[model samples]
Target: MATGPNGSVLVLTNPHDVTTDVVLRILADRQVPVVRLDPGTDLHTSAALTATYRTGDQRGTLRTPSRELDLTEVRSVWTRRPSPFEGPPGLGEQERRFAASQSLWGAGGILASLPGAHYVNHPWNNRAAEYKPAQLAAAQRSGLLVPGTLITNDPDQAREFATQQTGGVVYKPLWNTPYKADGQAQQVWVREVRPHEITAAVAACPHLFQAKVEKAFDVRLTAVGNRLFAVRIDSPDLDWRQRQSLMECTSIAVPDRVARSVSAYLSISRLAFGAFDFAVTPTGDWYFFECNPNGQWAWQPDSITDSIAHAVADQLENGPEA
Candidate 1:
């Protein structure tokens, strides 16, 4: 089915992201008028936005819902890019600083006022999705095996948990953030641990510790609406990201149990999408690791692009009809 231009979509994102550009292109191809809202603008009121991006090309000088924006005409919003605001090309330091500050705070206020817009992935929902502990609990409730885990600031407790696991455990960062400077990338490595290492680990702060299960395979399950894209990620190293050249991934069917879990998890999370990571033990049992709510999908094989894109378009065009 083809779509006609009527309602508009406002995309609030960073200006420099290629992925954001691609999504905008997709939306444009569907004939939707897109309004780009930069992160660092004082956009709380619709008037501020109208003075900015809502202009001659798409819709000229027309009044939006508020002095700055007309929310009623906005059918959907995609929060694709997030970046610190930058001043227009040649502003001085003080003026630039002022603009950036207002933009940052205003963007928040504006987005908050848009309660009626259908958010593909809202900020609050995205924050909730990143909690690793919650994901593990949710996965287990859905009947997926989870490695024995511990969260504690106590050195003694940490050591005890490690000692009890059949094989020692692995320490994983709660968040998968990398520290980068000057374009030189230094990645944190995942390593096997002995019980004795807990003393130092506990000193760092509360750590997310898990039993290092011997895995036969790794699975990345990407969910879009009711459809599931399961891929088997195989590699020679403990951390696949460590050896991209040696890592291999192939499209694979989801086990019945996993498919069910994936569906249930998405429904419970109030999300239309998720990227789940799993470790399949030698015994063929799949253990849940975590799910990234704002996971990347373009890297997946092209075989599933039709369904994924279709699901997105359907949701945008026929949302909850506010």
Candidate 2:
């Protein structure tokens, strides 16, 4: 690793993140110094971090393989999908647990407290906005159209809610939890739920049920600071992510009202970047679904990717707007 000067960007993410790769390329092109760290792989293993607080003075340093970062000198920090710290190996279970907790809250606290560092959606804010119910509430409060939603562990309630929707309802997981069935990893996808299908299994855990939107297409709006990039997606499946290869996507204009609401939502959530999903009805009404503060975007069209990379680079280089 090479040392970076004062006021460089710090990127916390996994090595496989193509989004980070694209952003790094853009930052490099502009001669911006960046220090990338993967907490899961480097922290406590190959990297070193120290934080000291005394007499109203706070200081910290993070030494990565290629560079040493003065926490206070970080101009921007991109908290993208960095894996959890696993602590040192060869320790007993309880010892390892204690060490991991300290690493998370101690070292993590120092990074989170970096003065003068602009976090592109701080980790705490990202965790707060991840709640589906909270996201829907925020969207609705921002004047965005949101589908009637129900979260419960009662099968009867689930069935009744599904029955009330004229277009029927869909079952979506509150969180996309990775699971393994028959030794293969699987992810839950949004699927239409028939009234009868809402059985006792609903009682096993909480589920999110929403009135299905009769949509002609879907929209993915990526907001980078004040800039919004909207893309129209046409797909036959309810969850386009499942069959992404078959989906057709094109850059589209965001409605003035929708754009304003998106900006407001981001402002209210204190996010500098977000990927919002919406279902567009045939009548042109856009129904808000959810927003991923650290959503994937590099897989999108080249034009969209380049635009987002530029916006992120600009923010990291120039700091937040007044």
Candidate 3:
């Protein structure tokens, strides 16, 4: 097998990531060098990285327990859910914060600046696509059907918009925030808005309200470079994630129009991988919901997981197709 300079598959993710574990196994089976780093734990603890630039050329090395990876020699980098940099344990809050900032820009920045290394979805690109409003706007521009949505901190405006939609509206957080109720962790799920539920508290923070699309099922399209895998998900709950055990997922074919839009969305977002969600109406029309640039895919069946793992490994081994 032909290998790149450093010839290593650098995977940046926490240890709990099953997706990364599966991909690592595939790369190993194929005899590709694999290096796993958890920035949160390994950055200043078990790993060391150094980057030097001189005469307009940059070079670096990343050393972990098992191997040393030449930054310039890396074939591809899989940037997954790396934990945030946390400084030493003994420092005060303010001092620790300062250290974290330095570590992030120092270590994280160098990783992001690796030359000739293909990032599965570049960290910058992943961050750019994280905004829900921007995702919706891009989807619409790509000729995908998007729900009529409103983002505001004005209760009056929110209520007015909710009343305007014939089928009623649903409220979703602009971004997910961790919450706890009665000492138990909870998540804010997309929920249909009741007429009486609209209140002045909506003015507290910016909220996203959209005309709820009546859908028979949800479709999750996982795009790996140019390969798109569509799955039909059926659930009785509005937010299927809340009741994953009750959901039935089946692999399905991507519609031509939807596929084109998916391509356009990825191009516009400058992302090589995206996990897209859609609401499929009874008539089969797909309404774009959002695309998670660094979304999870391990929960899928072996067929889907194997396909995704192969696609990712192929990209890492040979670099992205032109």
Candidate 4:
């Protein structure tokens, strides 16, 4: 592993991230300096930044209530789940919009532009990897087994595709975006859908439908750097994420074929870390579904979670390969 620039491991995330806390704990034990900031909420109230450029050199400082950090000293940036920028508190509608734009371009750009610091799956890379279409194309190119799939806005095509699947089709939200239901955030989980369920409403926008695998179980594989930790999840539900309590999790090794495919996929996607979901058939065929560039891993079994956290800490502490 190569050493990064000298200074703190900068963590840009919401204050309440349990996944981050695990890595932070290990970094703490290793006595690595860290400067945590939530740009969304803190930028307006508690944080300030200044950068100067002269004589073809750039230097800056980040000031927060608890710490003052030299911007150039950011060794690596973990842009983990940072919320959208929330501008100043009392601005009117027009002013708020303007402030929001300024903050995004100003603060967000600076963070993205740090001179010698490496980003753990940089924000731009994360956004690109989030697209299911891109992931599917990349997976196929990398030689990962992929289920028969379709993304369409035409109801007729959706119906035709669903009918062609012998094991039936499943509907999955392309983004799994949060929806407000009864004043609480809710998510639509993956579920089996009939051809009739592909109604005209699906024409309202693009819909992702896939041939449902009669999977013996699902695999959640967490890749940190070149290390992969996979957990086999056995569940009764059509979508295992629907009910985690009923999930039977056991650590599993990555198959050589799958490992090679994933490595190629990550290189193609320019991601240092990713959480991949796959469906394993009865005969041990692993089919790639999607890769989350900055997905959750701490929710896995304890050993897997701890090992991943340590791997992440090591990466942040030592930076990427030179």
Candidate 5:
């Protein structure tokens, strides 16, 4: 539906993202008033901001090339993965750092305070939901079956946990961040960890260990509002993501219980969207893995992709669900 002239949807993400490309295309078709702003790269480049404050309240406007979005009339804000906040043009490292911090509190504070705007996943809520431990607890509480898991920085704890799990244990990174190795970016992959291999080096940082879940397949379930789009991935590898080329993806219906559990998780996490990963065993049971609150969906089939885009656009244009 075309948005009325009074309100606008603010899409926050980088330009190169395909997910942004597709969503914006749909919003364009719907004639939704959208301000596609990449706060990081656009703040000092093509964007300008102004605000007025009363003793207890604040109001603001953000001007992009084609639009001046009324922050007060913003229906929603969809924050994807934007680039890091660039401080100012032609500035030194320390000076840039200071400016970025100021920008984050200054402009960011006003945006976050927009009274009527529905955040797909509020920035603060998104950050909190990203933690592995936090997500696991929410999934468990939401009634999804989760594997035996442990988080520890002690080598002895890691050894004792691994020895108790019959199917063996695997070490998975607590967070997904690339590391520089030989001047190239690399990520740690999930691998089996034998109790004998546990060493004092495990104490260097927090490590996530879980009982190995032998699975018939994996599910990439992307949820937008109340809709769940599940794609079953059949792969022989320990991590299907490690070898996407060999994995076969097929659309599947989510079990009613699974759907309800995910919805409950979204409520507990205070999120409007989530991309969940589940391990499906041969006996047709599902085990909770993790959920990416701001995960990608454009890679799925056009049916799923377009549906999610439209669902997201609907929320942005129409405000919160009734």
Candidate 6:
């Protein structure tokens, strides 16, 4: 575990997460040595699972034997979205159990044990970022205006909250994660809150209700290390996702307070990268919504890509603590 002069970085991701490729290419162009860890590899204890890659125009699997990673020699890691492991259909119950348990515990443990390495989005930090309640509180503590919010399983409480807001409310699921039941993908749809529908909403799941913000413009503030890129998104629809065709997005100058708060939020959240969503009123008030730790930014205006890429490379090269 020797800390070398030029350390290596491991990119933890699926093949399709294009941002991973974008970042990797930036690192490679700078001559940084990178080892890509494909998550779909078989799990048989951390020691037994040797990973191999098939290069361009190659056919059969090239089995690169397993070796323990030298954590001290590693500089940084990017924990991008990983694809789940898939085992063949013929495995019986016992074999299936062995593989599944190893995937969850064994692989996860190895990643945790890596020492003195900077992570753009660490696994533990990524987990903490998912709780919407905590994010709202943190945003306010960082001096950003967060829309009044309520998280509840009770129907009556939800109804009261909606009725109290002068401007109407909107409902967002705590986590927009989908569960597959009988081969169907169930997605959480973001929608306006009607006072009459509170009963059915409460019956469905624990709801996160917030006053719908009236806006002059909506902004997505993307921060990579110390660099910040703010983009103003214009959409007439209640939810921006609803107006993909008609919406306009453009880069905007971020207010100093908003920029400061965004930097502070990222520092407190222990993240090197974040995509922050804000709703801005015509009077110039910016209300913080939430920051996506693993947010998508390729959809943002093309001008931001270089800034983001450069920020990531600079952090990866010099280390975030520096």
Cα lDDT of candidate 5 equals: 0.86
The Cα local distance difference test for each model comes to 0.70, 0.88, 0.88, 0.89, 0.86, 0.76
TM-score to native of every candidate shown: 0.78, 0.96, 0.96, 0.96, 0.95, 0.86
Model 1 residue 202 lDDT?
76
How would you encode candidate 4's per-residue C-alpha lDDT over 1-322 as one tens digit per residue? Answer: 2324457888999988978999999999989899999888888888998878788788888999988988888889898998897678799988988888898898888888787777897888999999999999999999999999999999999999999998999999999777998999987999899998778998899999999987889999998878889999999998888898999999888999999999899999999999999999999999998999999888888889999998888888787762
For each predicted model, how many residue pairs clash, with residues at least 3 apart or on different chains? 12, 2, 1, 0, 0, 0
Q: Compared with the true structure, what per-residue lDDT tens digits does model 1 show for residues 214-273? A: 899888887766777788889988877688678777888888988898878876777766
C-alpha lDDT (0 to 100) for residue 200 of candidate 1 = 61
Q: Write the per-residue lDDT of candidate 5 for residues 205-316, one digit (tens) a residue.
A: 9999999998989999998888788999988789988988888888999999999999999999999989999999999999999999999888777887888888887777
* Off by more than 4 A, model 1: 1-5, 41-47, 50-69, 84-106, 177-185, 305-307, 320-322
Candidate 3 deviant stretches above 4 angstroms: 1-6
Model 4 quality (TM-score):
0.96
- Please provide, for model 2 over 1-322, each residue's C-alpha lDDT reduced to its tens digit, 9 standing for 90 to 100: 2223447998889888877888899888878889998876677678989888888677888897788878778888899989787778889999988988888898778777787788887889999999998899899889999999999999999999999999989999999888999999998999999999888988999999999999999999999999998899999899999999999999999999999999899988999999999999999999999999889988789999899888888878776671
Displacement of the residue 187 alpha carbon in candidate 3, Å: 1.2
Worst 10 residues of 2 by lDDT: 1-10
Model 5: what TM-score?
0.95
Give RMSD (Å) of candidate 1 vs. truth.
Answer: 6.1
Name the lDDT value of residue 172 in candidate 6.
Answer: 92
| lDDT at residue 258 of model 4 (Cα atoms) | 96
